[model samples]
Target: MTDAPGSEGPEPSEPPTSRREGGGLRRAHSAADASASTTTGARSARAEFETHVAHARAEFEEANERIKQRTGRDLILAIVIGVAIGVVVVASLIFFKWIFLLFAIAATSLGVFEFVRALRASGRRVDLIPQLLGGVVLMLSGYFVDLWLHWVLTMVVVVVLIVWRLLGQMFSRDGRTYGAVLSDVLITGLVVLYVPFLGSLAMILLSQDGGEWWALAFIIITVAADTGAYVTGLTIGRHPMAPRISPKKTWEGFGGAFVAALIAGVLLALYMLGLPWWTGLIIGAVILGTATIGDLGESMVKRDLGIKDMSSWLPGHGGVLDRLDSILPSATAALALFYLLSPLAVS
Candidate 1:
């Protein structure tokens, strides 16, 4: 090696870093950095997607697990009985319209029996004969008369029940307390409105032009709402709707019920009822409130009376009242709403 100018051995070779080369190097660095960033981002996105899928699957399994835990043979039996009753009701309404009245009378009778018997079980003596008579008359009035007559006859039946109770109390030798008589009268009146009054609306509903289809649509929407409530309550129900009345009910279930009712109502109005879509929505909301309240109201009765169910009239279905709990208020609401919306529908 030869000595270089200004110092040590041969001069060290300088690195090739001209302006052009330096610019190319910078570009290469930028490209490499961009490629690396792209790869990292892609990996992160894939990981996130996988996490989301896992979470969704887990939630689904949890919901199913809850259903599995809550469902049993009793529920299955209830479904069977309900389906049979539903088929009978539909056939009656569609094929033999008059025959539907017989079914209504029978249902009202049974509902009255169950209601009064439950009160009796709670140590409250109810005059079953007068109550049954009044219930039958109340239900039949809907068949024979217009809506106004129906109401008028309902008042007539109420007065008849009260008079009958008062006469019986006067004739009875037993020292019946005034409180007991008052309780008897009050409960008897409630039964009149609760069972036959509401059940009679079905007859009124059948009096409409497309009443047959309207009845079916009402049943379908009610079932849908009830299903939504049952499923949602079983799966994710956390907040109690009325814990004292119905331990199984929940706000989440109500939400599910509302959504299901809304969807069913819209579809039925559009395709079946020939009404405006909003009509179904409003009717659905009405039915939802009334049906839920009816259910809770009955539950309150059972709770207050200290009974599990009205009776075991239908296996696994508790009683006629239990199965018809939602039907009563739903029928009334549907009939009233239909008449309100369509003046011509009123008979």
Candidate 2:
């Protein structure tokens, strides 16, 4: 392999710098391709995740809508509010008994306020101040004083309400007829008897020894009954219990309520109150009757007033009265049960 002078051997073996530069360019191109592939894969993954999330959200919304249609209310909101109220009540009952008295007074006042507002909305004259004052006094008397004093104060409040209304009408130039005044007086009386009076019974129960537990027991059972009825009715309600009063109520619901109340009563009496198991049945039956009647009575009042609810103060609960309807009457029943069953409880 002898080469002549000035011969270009193997094309002078490509320059080292040029070869390095060419290799660098090819490597850069390879890197760019890999980056593009990675970006595409990331986009595809993100798109898939977004689609799954959207589908899940749609399913949740659909379920919520179905519940609303079946219950005529937002079930989730109702449950949340209901749980919050339960917590407050339980805390007040457990931590300090006096706190419950205050809670009751406040609740009754609000309920009376709602009722008065509803009555006024229906073109009826109502005295809100006296009702609130009377309710507070009733609860205080029941808690601090004796049952007799509570009754006496209740009568005093009634008379004051009547006189207040009569004097207001007498002085006013509205020309409201005597019959109208009478109707107003009657309604005022009803407001007292329905809310404060029954609610005071709970105060009386709390005043007694071990009465707090009884109060809690009855309340739990009442709530259980309400929950059972709501679930059963929403699930398989057919025959109307009171089509005229409450079309949503059904016999099936009532049956469910009965079973739930009985179970709750039995458990509470046996474990918490330490009363005979049979007493639980009695408690359940009595509370069920009273609660159902109270619910129906409130519904009848709403029907007469031509209002869907007393007020929309509580979002999912309608009004304070709406929530208290069952509890108010059940308070009286619970107090009575306490007296009758106290003898059987373990000392």
Candidate 3:
């Protein structure tokens, strides 16, 4: 249809294909706008998540720094090492009892080695070879022989160490004096009695029927007390329990240790050892006393030796002796308790 000049004919109706094209374009634009909106929302969500993650990371770092500043050691590293030791011990204990014997032997040997080195550092002479050999024999005796034999062998080792030290002094090129020989003999006796003798008690415990569980129970309780003391002292400790010995240790921390030991003892007695829950109290009390004394005793030794650690063999923990201090004495206590409480245990 033709329209006159300056006049429209029926408003010039649009073509059908053109109208469809225009409608399609409008739909496409709407879709594009919706997609853009969705993308923006997703980006916002992602940014928020990242922000939260950053905040959490920052908080963790701050906490870690605080722990480091207070403890003079990396908390995470200590936990990792502690966990690794625990895994090895647990695996050896659970898989085979004899494997734990090997573990004990190795631990005692290392402890003796470290002690010898520490003494040597102080210019004191120690017979490392005899001590190591004697330690192995003592551990073997504890495992293979009866209780009486174990005691006899322990005394024999001490005497052997003393005599060996005396003979070495007599035959030495350095021409030792009586005072030096006496000191060496005394130190030798201390080493044998301290490391191997107490360690043998654990072997003895493991030799008994169902002794592995008791050993594990005592170990768990000791670890619990240590962990509780550490955490509590770091968080809210004020008054020092033994400032001259361990400045970081606090009464509050000791209380925490007591509580944790009590709980651990109860649980282990009831579940692991199949004993009366009340027995856990006794076990906990005994272990706590021994563990505390052991820790303090070691600290005193280190203070006298003028060293912060026995050695840096185990990172964040000092050395093997440092780790074994509590366990070594607790072993004796645990064995005694086993004899005392065996009647109450479930068969």
Query: How many angstroms is residue 73 displaced in model 3 relative to the true structure, after the best TM-score fit?
Result: 1.9
Runs off by more than 4 Å, candidate 2:
1-57
- The weakest ten consecutive residues by lDDT in model 3 span 8-17
Better model by lDDT, 2 or 3? 3
Tens digit per residue, CA lDDT, model 1, 44-68 = 9999999999999999767655554
lDDT of 3 at 25: 76
Model 3 residue runs over 4 Å out of place are 1-32
- Report the C-alpha displacement of residue 343, candidate 1, in angstroms: 5.7
- Writing each residue's lDDT as its tens digit, candidate 3 over 100-202 gives 9998999999999999999999978998999999999999999999888778888888898888887887788697777877888899999989998899899
Top candidate on TM-score is 3
Model 2, residue 251: what's the lDDT?
96
Q: How far does residue 117 in candidate 2 sit from its true spot (Å)?
A: 0.3
The weakest ten consecutive residues by lDDT in model 1 span: 64-73
Per-residue lDDT, model 2, residue 250, is 96
lDDT of 3: 0.91
TM-score comparison, 1 vs 3, better candidate? 3
Q: Which stretches of candidate 1 lie over 4 Å from their true place?
A: 1-73, 343-347
Q: Which scores greater on TM-score, model 2 or model 3?
A: 3
